[model samples]
Target chain A: MYAFTYHRPDTVRQAAGLLARKDDAKIIAGGHTLLPTMKQRLASPGALVDLGGVPELKGIERKGRGLIIGAMMTHAEVAESAAVQEAIPGLAALAANIGDPHVRHRGTIGGSIANNDPAADYPAACIAMGAIIVTNKRKIPAEDFFQGMFGTALEEGEIVTKVAFGIPSRSAYAKFRNPASRYALVGVYVAKRGGEVRVAVTGAGASGVFRWTAAEEALKKRFAPKSLEGVKADPSGLNSDIHADAEYRAHLINVMARRAVEAALGK
Target chain B: MAAVSMTVNGKAVTADVEPRTLLVQFIRENLKLTGTHVGCDTSQCGACVVHVDGKAMKSCTLLAVQCNGASIVTIEGLAGADGTLHPMQAAFREHHGLQCGFCTPGMIMSAVDIVNRKGSDLDEHTIREELEGNICRCTGYHNIVRAVETGAKAMAGSAPVRQAAE
Candidate 1:
């Protein structure tokens, strides 16, 4: 990686101040993606404000009707938390399946959403479950938080503090992962809560994580996998890469959506 | 340059390193612990896996400066002062888990953590799933999985399980 100064701040204000004061500073949450990109010269910030030292961004607990997950909490913490498993087992299962054990140990929920990688699982779960992204500045709804591929509504020096996800009445996530990196080739998250049905598709979106309104509306009419049998998702805006073509990805989205609905109903 | 201090194994040490220096580089170059190998420059390989505050993490992916004041354990620290190997280490040898041995350190570190979390009740499928981070090209993971299973039981029988407090 290009040479850079590292600053470990104990609080969000300190971290934000470091970012504001530096010429070119980036927030280092897990460093799983940032460090590798820097090493390859794809990204080179003059300084890094490490969030690992901030204690405020590290935990998971039940608050009211949802689970309040500290932004810095690793995937392992979410997967293993009895509270998370009890309140939202589907979300916990998604966390457990991300990358491998080592990656999960280092990667954080806040970083995952903040980075907004096209194939990340958290965005799907966030959008499907109606999660709230609580940053140092303001709380943004999941739909408003994700703007596009590798993009979010976060501004410069804005730090995500935590994410609050309401416990869905029923939810399940199914992903066909690329075997090599274990990232979703095409993943679907199905959620049914309070007479509202929402389906979010990740990894296959050209515009990043998006809600499949057609399938969601269909499922809303009848909560069953067969409800989406006739609903063919358009392949127009799906991602096409070496792993899978746009047509195949669009086809898999339908299959995954059906399976997600089945899984959620079974739960 | 930055000054980082941490407990490695049972020893407290300090070093002045650039913020860009990786933890694997600090452990291998600064401390001369060569057991931790760097198979992939990227974080894809688990060869640089080490226990940071009792949790397995890719040392290659983390900057040395990020590990300040943390307790780290490398493959070299798995044995007793009397030269007795950790049960996981012992099981690897008995099960013939290594051939090239490039991935052994990471495999052993990840194996111990798996057992630490799952205990002796780990089944074949769970062992395979948990070992996903570690890649053993030589043995095709047949023996590595066996070693982890045998090691988990041996570790559970021998001492108080080290829970991952992190």
Candidate 2:
């Protein structure tokens, strides 16, 4: 890893100030992705603004009909949180399945969504549940927050503070993970709230995590796995790699989506 | 260079290190406690697992500077001061959990953490699932799973195990 200056800021204001002051300074929450990237020389920022010291960016609480999770809450914390378990059990299950125990202990929800990896689980959950990505400067809706793989609507010196997720009537996530890295080979998240239903797919999008509108439309008609029997995900823009070809990914998307719906229904 | 201060095992230690210096480097190089091995520095392999602030974390993935004011416990600190092995360590020896022993330290640390979080009565499936982060290429994980189950039971029978020095 390249040698760089590290600044540990105690507050969001101080963190933003440090980012503005330092050239090419990157925010380090859990440092799971950024640290590995730096170790491989894929990224070399001149300075790192460590957010681990900021107490403001931590905690998980239920507010009204939604859940407000602080950005710095670790994956382990989210998985073990009684609030998350009672409010949104599927979200807790997703958190529990990320990376592994050791990685979960250090990796945070804020870091995961901010990185916006194409294969990440949080993106699918956010988009499916219509979450709100709250940053120090503004609050961006989940649909507008993610741009593409490794991209977000975050501006320079912007730091994510928390994410607000509305508790859906029913929701669940299913993923076929790469055995080696445990990243999603093809993952689907299904959420249904009132008359609206959203189905989000991750790890198989050429562009990035995207909503499967056809499946969503079919499910809107009938919120059941059988409703998706004839629905198909077009293989055109899906990711193709050694792990799975575009056709296989498209096929798995249908299968995983059905599985997610089944899980949400406790079938 | 950055000056970092933290509690390792039972002692409070201070060191000057590069900003990029990993927590494993500090534990092994500066502190001269070499029990925590760095099998895969990229964080895929869990040979460098250690307890930081009462939780098992990948030391190699953490910058030493980030651990300032944190409490850390390596494999060397798991046993009693008089040299009695930790229940998990003893279980591993009895169950022959290691072949090359390269991944034993991390496996043991992770096992203790599992018991701490999930309780002592662990099933085989739960143990296998919880061992996801720590990879062992030897013993086919059969013996390791057995050791974890036995160790967890032993931990339940024993007094609340003291983690690191206060």
Candidate 3:
């Protein structure tokens, strides 16, 4: 790893100030993805602003009709939080099922969303639930936040403060994970609120993460596994790798969507 | 380098380490805690797993300077003062959970934390799902899962751990 200045600010404002001043500074929240990249020389930031000491960036709470999770709240905390499980059991289950116990305990929601790895699970949950990402600068809707693979709309030095997920009537995340990394080979998150249904697909599509409009529309009419039949994922825009081919991923999109629907329905 | 101080295995220690020095590196190198193996430099492998502030974490992926003033527990500290094996360690041995054992320290550490937080009632599916980040090249997961089960039972004080399942 290259040499860099490390600063552990006690407050978010101080961290933000350090980030704004350094031309190439990276915020370290959990450091699951970023640190590895740095070690591989994929990223060579001039400074590292550690967010672990920031008190304001680590918590989980229910704020009115939504769940507000601090950016630094670890996956383990999210998976085990009584409030999260009670309010969004699917979210908790997804958290509990991510990477592994050690990764869950170290990786944070902020780091996962910010890194936006195509196979990561939190993006699907955020997009499906119509969550709002609260950053130091502005609030970004989940729909507009993700730009592409390993990309988000976040500007430099803009530390995510919290993510606010709207409490859904019911929601579920289903994925066929890669055996090695446990990242989704093809994952789906289906959320229902009122009469609307949102389907977010990760790890399958070529665009990395996209909404399955056909599946969503079908499920909105009647939320059921059968409803997703014949609604094929566009294989042209799907990812293909050694773990799974495009055709297989397309099939998994349908299969996982069905399972997600079933899970959401408590079947 | 930065001057940092923290408690490791219930003892206070201070060291000057590079800003990029990972906590696991500091523990294994400076403190000579080689039991905390470094598997993948990436966070995907939990081989560098350790308890930070009483929570399991991928220490390889975290900067040592970030852990200033925090409490840490590594595999070296899992044993009792009298050198008795931790319940998870005993269970692993009883269940033949380790083959080559490269992943044993991490697997055992992760399992211990999982049962501590999730409880002894954890089903096989949950344990399988939770072990996703921990890779065992020997593929001894069949026994690892059984070990976690037996260890959890022991933790709950239900009974002496049973033999490996099937």
lDDT of 3: 0.88
Per-residue accuracy of model 2 over A83-126 as CA lDDT, tens digit each: 99999988999999999999999999999999999999999999
- TM-scores, chain B, all models: 0.94, 0.94, 0.92
List the RMSD of every prediction in angstroms: 2.8, 1.9, 3.7
**Predicted model with the maximum lDDT:** 2
* Candidate No. with top DockQ: 2
The C-alpha TM-scores of every prediction are 0.97, 0.98, 0.93
lDDT of 3 by residue, A100-146 (tens): 77777778999999989999899999999999999999999998999
- Specify the highest-TM-score model's number: 2
Candidate 2 docking category?
A: high
Worst 10 residues of 3 chain A by lDDT: A97-106
How many residue pairs clash in all the candidates, one count each? 0, 0, 2
Clashing pairs in 3: A206-A237, A206-A238
Scored against the true structure, residue A167 in model 3 reaches a CA lDDT of 96
For model 2, which pairs clash?
none
| lDDT, each prediction | 0.92, 0.94, 0.88
Which ten contiguous residues of candidate 1 chain A have the minimum total lDDT? Answer: A258-267
